[model samples]
Target chain A: MPRTSRAVKLAALPDGLPGPEHFSVVDVPVPVPADGEVLVRNRYFQVFPSLRTLIGGGVKGTPFPPLRPGDTLFGAAVGEVVAAPGVAGLRPGDLVRHWLGWREHAVMPAGQCAPLDGTLPDPAAHLGQAGVAYTALARDARVRPGDTVFVSGGGGGVGSLAGQIARLLGADRVVGSTGSPDKAARLVSELGYDAAVVRGGRPIAEQLAEAAPGGIDVLVDNVGGEQLQAAITAARPGARFVLVGTLAGQLAPDRSGTTAPVEIDTFQLIAKRIEMRGFGGLDDAGPRPEWTERVGAWLRSGDLTFPHVRVAGIEHAPRALQELIGGRHLGAVIVEL
Target chain B: MPRTSRAVKLAALPDGLPGPEHFSVVDVPVPVPADGEVLVRNRYFQVFPSLRTLIGGGVKGTPFPPLRPGDTLFGAAVGEVVAAPGVAGLRPGDLVRHWLGWREHAVMPAGQCAPLDGTLPDPAAHLGQAGVAYTALARDARVRPGDTVFVSGGGGGVGSLAGQIARLLGADRVVGSTGSPDKAARLVSELGYDAAVVRGGRPIAEQLAEAAPGGIDVLVDNVGGEQLQAAITAARPGARFVLVGTLAGQLAPDRSGTTAPVEIDTFQLIAKRIEMRGFGGLDDAGPRPEWTERVGAWLRSGDLTFPHVRVAGIEHAPRALQELIGGRHLGAVIVEL
Candidate 1:
């Protein structure tokens, strides 16, 4: 007998804030595995800010297709395989994490699903948040020990993991900027950040000066515009300013009131010889079999830890997304069916 | 009998535009060279825009001491050595070039002066404009063959030589921006620029699009502000934007009738992987003895030609500066005494 599954589908495009009306739950037949494919019954789904951007008409200059009405909201998920289609190594009843959608059941190519090592405390750790964030922070930032790393929006899913990863990588000092004082405290006490500052209340430069005192060496900026400018001003000579988001605003405001476009003094760069870079998540890059092996080892060895996940049902994914958009949540918001 | 020399000395700090009142010419007894010092009779002095910025108190956070009232006005210059203080390989009546000052005579350490080979058409070529500009263009910009190079302020001293050096480096296409159509015509016809666009008239992106068609790979910018923004917009992925000057105004005006601080989009950097670097002439870190040797070789071999220079007497130094400040001259303005 074929199994039935509940899935979250994009009901409509969101304007400013995503609501329950923007998503709808529907029942669908579990997909059957085709050649070189595996059948997975998803247990956990990942919700993130990029999803918000995606639902709002997608990122500019993106070459991929955009999410449309009635389409199942796509994301990476953790599931258990009931059957495999002509694939070796992967067997029935294996817990796996794969890139699929919000559906309770998914049929993906065998290459997409990686067998979750039983050694991990929770298989969902590999699927939703910890996996992508850790891989991105490690590979893209090239985090190292004795380096001073600053994470903007530190309370968010990626920022929280990035801070932890920085600490695990031997960062001598880890500073974070969050939207609230509670988030700031959590970032410090719970996430191993050396210091945390509340954003928007005070001048970021002044706050950073109090936090780091000796200028930041590596700034992982997810909040752009004014925050980015403050970070730039607070950066030490030869610092690296990495842009990961522009949540604050697209353009930096002119404080001097000259009505002129911001003219970055190239001399700052000349004097300090700083390098600025940007990075997106690693989902686009094909599965790094070694990443799984290594992160799995780290997870098993207790060298890395996963953040507390807020789980919701598939029907409540829209509420979870709304919470993420409102910046009310501190960790990964995962939806389960 | 004591020898007499004329020197221009800084009088007082001016509020904005420096004038003849800010400088005083006085006669002094030329002193004999001490051990490790060489006495040179000055020939040519270079008037640069950086001097203007310095005089206007525009640069901030610089390590060097600011100009003091009644201090000698020093800059890059060329002269003939009349006395060598116990120095080997240098003799009286030998023409040399050193960053001395705007004076009729100067006594610098023997280690500072480099003996100029007489093969050049004019010894003033080393002192006037060729050295700093060519060294900056060759070593800093790293101009290579087949690169599409864009030069701003092509009618000025550094821009002219930068264009010539780009050509000498075998750049496949070279475009320049000038303040006037006459300069643009001169840049295209006489200076061998592939195309020249009038500055402040047309949008730089549109002009660059029409000129290069493909996109600019290397930008040697002398005029900053809006042109810098436009250059960033027109840059090809992985292109280099080199900031060498800020003549087009330092602050960019914004929409709210206020001046916006200059800030680059770190996202654009990630998407395009572009590198924006600043080249501040041959300072301490740049190729020094090797650069002098190589440029000297090029000059001696007649492979690099020097631009025409307008000469003024020592008393006319203030007027020459005025002319430069007013943008009245082309090529280099050299004060020969």
Candidate 2:
């Protein structure tokens, strides 16, 4: 058995767009499981846009504790349990999902790990495409049949899956917005989006109005700021908006305070009776197991496909995350250990 | 019975604050009820802040049609059915609530009228205090017992009632915001608010933070713009925000688009997982009858009291509406026709 492991650690709290310098990949002794704990050998981990919020100055009074210097960067990962100590649900070689990523080996409490149903050929796909997107759509947005759904950052991993999930949920029309026209075209052609709107160069509202002339019934928003504002404008009366990410500002290189803060005109929320909700990983925690079962069934039935960007080697995780945050990656960025 | 009836008509759309000059009082032949219709002699009409939205150049594709030149400004009214033509549920003397106000007499379809339970001595109170506010708090906000509730524009018609209703619904603490210190004191002393934050001079967020430092579980927002922004800042994780009015912008004298649009940092929405929804009269249409019944029961039991400003004579309605929009009058503004 390997007696050493490698993990990414936060070297410093980032003030703005984080760079590779803020993270350090270092070798450490392999963790051993204690009583009622499991030692998992990570197969794959996710590098998502939300990592920006975690590394950027922490949200004031955030419910989840902010990552500090010297702490291992944590995220959802799929792995095989190499060792288990008096744990009822797990045995060595069992596949599980746990929040102990950016690492090769992790020692976690057995109860915190979820056993995968083995329906997906590559179970690591659950870390991104099938996880947050599924829970947010099913529990938060509650996408209904015949809903005219719009997704922001639709070319990204979760957004791409969100389009498919909306279709599965019986959405009549699914429109996705991406940063470039090429990606927009790809989203519609390959990702099952009914239509795609290019996000930049003009006010998102004007572009969205032109695309969704009638109005959006449900908005799965990954890019906040102006994109969200545009979705609000394009929303029909009684539309539902779910906040999934704030990638619009995640890629900005200039972290200067002088930049005018991106603003959203909330008047539309009142005038049109729009319902908006923000969701995070913790919010999806309770419903995740149910969503996982459903997603597994869909995967087994060939009803779903996940688009992802895989990077070989655990040493490349910092760069992979940077690529995601920099908007260089179009789909979920996965690190293969 | 008089053969003629007088009504207030919109003279022209105002660019800014509307005055009596924008309305014209004229006499017209009393409308005769046809089959399945009733001729109502309006006893009392409401002049609410939302009227500004109706007359202010229309809210784009507003469901409530913009009041045009020579068009009767419609609103909720409590009146006596003077004549009913084959209406099964109505009698000539029965009091009813309907959206046919700003007039001395209105001919309305029988199906549109909502019969008041006749529990209160002055059923005209049904138009303002006991109408939309109760319905919105119960249905839209979904105020649960032990919730920490906050009401913006708490001294106004809907805000005042929202405070009491939150308390009646078993809220642990009810905090309210008012534009003036006197009204702030009144809200805490006269109304059932646990505390009152005066909104002016300093940023409202500062005052609200000081008032409800722990954070609000539910926000019943009446004044939009900065008040809504401030509430969003002060909301707790998973807080429920119900948008009831945009009187904050309505009260602003400058109607120029140059004025910085009221901005809400929606990043906070995602960070805290806030749930926000806009509430309008139409939003309450489904639950109103049941809410009215519940309110009538509360009123009969002396468990509820409605504070309102009653202006005598139909001639005073236009000015009364201006007062409500201009933030001069406290509580619900009603005109006795």
The top-ranked prediction according to lDDT is: 2
Model 1: CA > 4 A from native: A1-147, A161-172, A250-263, A280-303, A306-315, A331-337, B1-45, B59-100, B103-147, B154-158, B161-172, B250-264, B280-310, B314-322, B329-337
Top candidate (TM-score):
2
Candidate 1 backbone overlaps, count: 24
Each prediction's whole-model lDDT (CA): 0.69, 0.79
| All candidates: TM-score | 0.74, 0.93
> Per-prediction DockQ, in order?
0.23, 0.50
Model 2: docking quality category: medium
Window of ten residues with lowest summed lDDT in model 1 chain B: B251-260
